[model samples]
Target: MQNYTLLPEWAKQEAVILAWPHAGTDWAENLVNAQHTYVALINAVNRANAVVLLLCPQDEIDAATAALASNNQVLIVPSEYNDTWVRDYGFLTVSDNHKNYPISFTFNGWGQKFDATKDNQVNSSLAKLCQQPLIENSIVLEGGALEIDENQHLLSTASCLYNPKRNAYMTGDEYHTLFIECLGAKKVTIFNHGHLEGDDTDGHIDTLVRFTPLKGIVLQGADNRPHDPHFAELFKLQYEVSQALPTHKIYSLPLPLVLDDEGTRLPASYANYLIVNQHIIMPIYGQSEDKNALVIIQSAHPNYTIVPVLCHSLVQQNGSLHCVTMQVPTNTIKPEIIAKAQLGVSIL
Candidate 1:
């Protein structure tokens, strides 16, 4: 099988894909608040990179377009989806010898925990819409579930990747094989522990650990509130990464105590930030941690602009900046780059 080199999120991108919230969807109640965050994101991203905003229920198009009418960088397109988590349903772009292609893997709505029939067709629809080459695969995966370094080493979690609901009967080695043969993974590491309390996506890696462009990790550190349910697991998270990247610089940001009035915890993590061309669109929950998150990211990438998008309502839907935005990487595979990469060489 020809390998597909996975591009890191920190690379230069043409556009950021966002599935906008609407009244006829699950975000109907939080529709106004959610759209506020989405609008902020669209505007921020458009300032530096193009914003691909996907709207459902055709009727909602005019209103969505009207909101961001000022920004010519915002591209509004009608779409059909089970929900608005496009990071999980959207296409993953990989470079095979410089030519870029979008990889479409089966999204089972976070382990088939939700409806994904329409959401599953998103990649093909998007490929036709963008006129990019689409590489279709039946492997169950999500854009938010894996982290790739500049070296193409994939960092993912065991709970989400190997769950029986996603890939039953397939051993861990078999799944690792898919990463190599399909996703262009030179190596694969499965972090076994640590998860958020109300997380439904089986501890997606984006919410747990983020790869810093500085060869470090921006991990979700536990707050002074030692009673947080996932405190013990967070310790394990730090230890696991320290063991993996010994020389890498690790930065820890405080976690917010964001739970619903009914006491349901929301999956809020500073590590779930979206890194675009020259901007870092981070998630803010109106907590003090929001400032620290911004400061830490800004310090790490002083060259890039840091934009914070209020995700209080979006977390109610169990996601944040990175969960909603997937970047479109530039296709740079030339003939020489492909020839070297084909024989187990680095494109970087």
Candidate 2:
């Protein structure tokens, strides 16, 4: 396989794909809320781009169709999935300006901890739907573990991608070689992130730091309390690493005070906002810092509409907007071709 990296937002996309949640897994108890959230996401993203939704084989697509019936910016394709975390299992797209393909690396439910056999086929099916080549890498790779800059710089955490359980067959250097041959990442940009009590992915970059087009990166900060230890360690680690980056800029967003209900800490962070074509969608917990986070994100993305989705139930699942939604690059096919494809689907 040739080395490849993700195309920038400005790159052309064929369409955005999302896997709907099922009661079997990923949304066992929260299937209803996840469905509503999925609808809202479809509504929002369809404003600026075409959306292709993946549905379970035996599942009813009427709910999605009813919610989006008034809106003509979507297409629902029947597909099967074990979970709704498509960002990790969905295809990772790459292009070289002339040709484009969807990369389908092996997904082992983030190291076989979760049932993922069905989730693995998303890449091939998505590629077949798009009529593009499906690039398959035997190694286990999750989209959540990577953050890239336009300048070829990458950011990742050892706790998530480098976990021994995730890739016991490969060493660190061996993994780097795979990155070079598989994903055109120049080099792995590493940072030391401390563990948080409620964090399940062990420091996913989307929850810890995010790169902004204008203001650089807005990161989650824990500079005050020392009792949890992660407060001091994660805060310092984020600051030091940001200062070290020569080309990219950085800004710190205040981390929300951890929410706990009945002695359980919940994963909460303002960094989990999603970037659509014209809007930056975020989850709101009605906290005082919500305003602050919005202001910061708005200032960073001046051209985008700052959309806040009510995420009370979403946080209970330990992820926010970015964690749930994946952006498929638009303009992948030529404009004339896309226009023809659009004509095939009814305008209703």
Number of the predicted model whose lDDT against the real structure is largest? 1
Residue 164 displacement in candidate 1 (angstroms): 0.8
What CA RMSD would candidate 1 show?
Answer: 6.8
- Computed on alpha carbons, the lDDT of every model, listed in order, comes to 0.78, 0.66
Model 2 residue 346 CA deviation in Å: 8.1
Q: Which stretches of candidate 1 lie over 4 Å from their true place?
A: 332-348
For residue 126, what is the lDDT in candidate 2?
58
Candidate 2 positional error at 47, Å? 1.9
Q: List the residue pairs that clash in candidate 1.
A: 97-333, 97-338, 98-332, 98-333, 99-333
Best by TM-score: 1
